[model samples]
Target: MKLVEITLDYPYNGGETFCKQELEIAEKYFDEILLISMSGHIGEGNIRYVPPNAKLINARKARYEASVYLKSFFQLLRIRTIREIVFAKKKLRTKESMPQILKEIFIYYYYANLLKRVFEKEVIEDDDILYSYWMAAPAYYLSIKGKKALKVSRTHRFDCFIEECYQPFRREIIEGLDCIISISEAGKKSIEARLIPFTSCLSEKIKVSRLGIMKKSSATDFGGKSNKYFTILTCSNIHIVKRLDLMIKALEKINIPVNWIHIGDGELGEQIRTQAKVLDSNKYVKYTFKGVLTQQQIYDFYERNHIDLFVNCSDSEGVPVSVMEAISFGIPVIARDVGGNSEIVSSENGILLDKNITPKVLMEAIRSILLLDDDKYINLRKNAVRKYRECFMASENYSNFFEMLISMAKEK
Candidate 1:
């Protein structure tokens, strides 16, 4: 009857920009949609436009009161907590301290209990689809409480990477949800592997539903343009994992003229800026930092600019939408081969770098692209466009995703 979608700061801040396109598609299928924001930080920027049929619920402030923590302290005795403890002991490596594991377990149950309180107040029906954008507390809570509802959750980088982090009750969450939509095949495989240790037969429920962007009318042209400097572009939050500093260090060593443009800002913005200043002395390297831009603004930038390469040096990813966006414009990419990045970027379209890519390695990759013969470079651009049309086109991917959702809901 209705679809309830849970998200972290969607339609609020610049975060979760990918959700907007999916929501636009989802609104067409679901009669009534409830968009719930569970983020602690809200009202930072303009709230994104919501579909006419979708109702926005700002549950960002939803959390247990200090007194509620005392009252619900007995929740620690539950079987889920025991299972999480055992999972941590067996699966978690020495890098994760016992105290840290315990704290994560406590926080997991704390948020689960908090979501439980929030869900109790909502008027949900048996046939309504409960969709969580991430396999976090919302999905966990819905799986346990959403009786007869077609419960689904989309798993991405942080929530799905168990080997990288100690996520409490991953097995339990997988067991509870009816379907797990992974943004990449690698993510789906990771979830399946996590299920193996528990002898869980829920791998069939895990499916890969790649994220996409709307197709562009025209791809980037590689012909008949003379520019003073070879322009390079990178767009992502300037976080530690993003490794903007690595990109900067690489740019410093380049002998040829380059104009590096960075989009987006984060906690490491100032630090990255300081690191980028080192490039000023290198006449060969010029850089600019365009603070956070909306999705439209990014599209506009791609439309107006001549980007020779789009680079991502992130330590982890879920097939970054930025890459998809670049490929949509037929811009060749040079990204670290991590997560689902390899699935989209390859030798034909772009260069997939090693996960342990250093400044020198990145510089070499950039130089390789810049030095490609005009025919080879144009072919790469064409292949990039072909990849976008084949996999990352929003109309094709999201339509099939929502259609599947509608079919699943009808079965319920």
Candidate 2:
């Protein structure tokens, strides 16, 4: 079968490190592959771990035409435009960003036209597949036109959470697609529930497909740790949603000294740095902002260093790949119970805090792990490794997902 995968920006730039591995795994399932990305960053590195025979296309090059805008405006008017306008007023909190919504609508219309042109030019067959990386705007837009190819979309947190998008996400787009996959059970539930407005039977169309990580060669040794120094590691784009401030504040409240390591960078990098200095003034917390590191660099850090625990205080998430990476290396996680985090963390493997977590709650969770006896700590480490092997290992889950896709394609 031929596979045509679409992403906002995966193999073309930084972020979505797991996507590189996903693309590589997908290569084995299809004889021919074409990767389509809406946009990409130019500078640093190639993010795709694709096979040598695959092709790449950037759909972002679709030029903006006034005709396309006019067409999209009329299209929006026919489908939930009034509701979207109301949603924008209530959710966005500003009229200034309404233009952004219009811009997205235009982009989506442009992409649909672009895909139609690609189908005409490249001659996509009925048996070929169009797999969208996210079940949001792109998938919705792409499904607006073409139906010859089997359409599948993987719905992550942002797409599953309707409030995250200002415009009312038309479920008809998803309903028309052949299959919809969710990264977590929580996400699956949300997606299924959202479809009730369209059809009662549509819930069965959404399936839970957990994201996986490559297992480490050897599990991290839990025995040897410096009594004086405890290291807490977190990997994510430094953003307000990540709530890095909560982590810093929690560290400040803790009596035990901590070395906090952040492995990613973003617009909030400088703000986080400034806050880190303020917390480090009394010497209770020492922050190391490692900027952005490649996927190999992250694995190397896990291999060479003794990271005591992994922490995630994000406001929201799907299934976090960074958490999977940490547990694969036998590091216990302390993540807020939001989104799909509870799927990975539990009483046996790691700690889960309430969604509305404060510094006191976070500090307590951290101290509970830190103050555990050696045997208990080692047990947690063992459980972490076991969890990764059973649930999050790449070989098992990805292969099963690929087989499912092949079966679905044949049925179609």
Model 2 steric clash pairs: 11-48
Q: Write the per-residue lDDT of candidate 2 for residues 1-412, one digit (tens) a residue.
A: 7888887776676656667667668888888888877653633365467677688776644445466556666776645555555544664343436677766655665566655655566757888888888876668765665557788888888777665554334455666687889989998887666554554445777888888987546656666344787988999999999999998888877787888889999999999889877676656677789998877789899998888899999999998989998888888899999999999999887798899978999999998887788888888888988888889888778888878888888898
Instruction: Give the per-residue lDDT of model 1 (tens digit) for 1-412.
Output: 8989988778876678888888888888888999888766565667887889998887635343675465456777778677677767776442588788767776666666666666778888887888999888777777777488889999998888777777676776788888899999999998787654674655788998888998545646555222689989999998999999889889888998999999999999999998888999998988899998878889889888889989999999988999999988888999998999999999998899889878999999999988888889989999998998899888779899988877887787
Candidate 2 ranges beyond 4 A from true positions: 40-47, 62-101
Q: How high is each candidate's TM-score? A: 0.93, 0.90
For model 1, the superposed segments whose C-alpha errors exceed 4 Å read 60-64, 68-74, 77-79, 215-219, 224-226
Candidate no. 2 TM-score: 0.90
Clashing pairs in 1: none
lDDT of 2 at 183: 88
Among all candidates shown, the one with the greatest TM-score: 1
Single out the weakest 10-residue window by summed lDDT for candidate 2: 87-96
Please give the lDDT score at residue 23 for candidate 1. Answer: 84
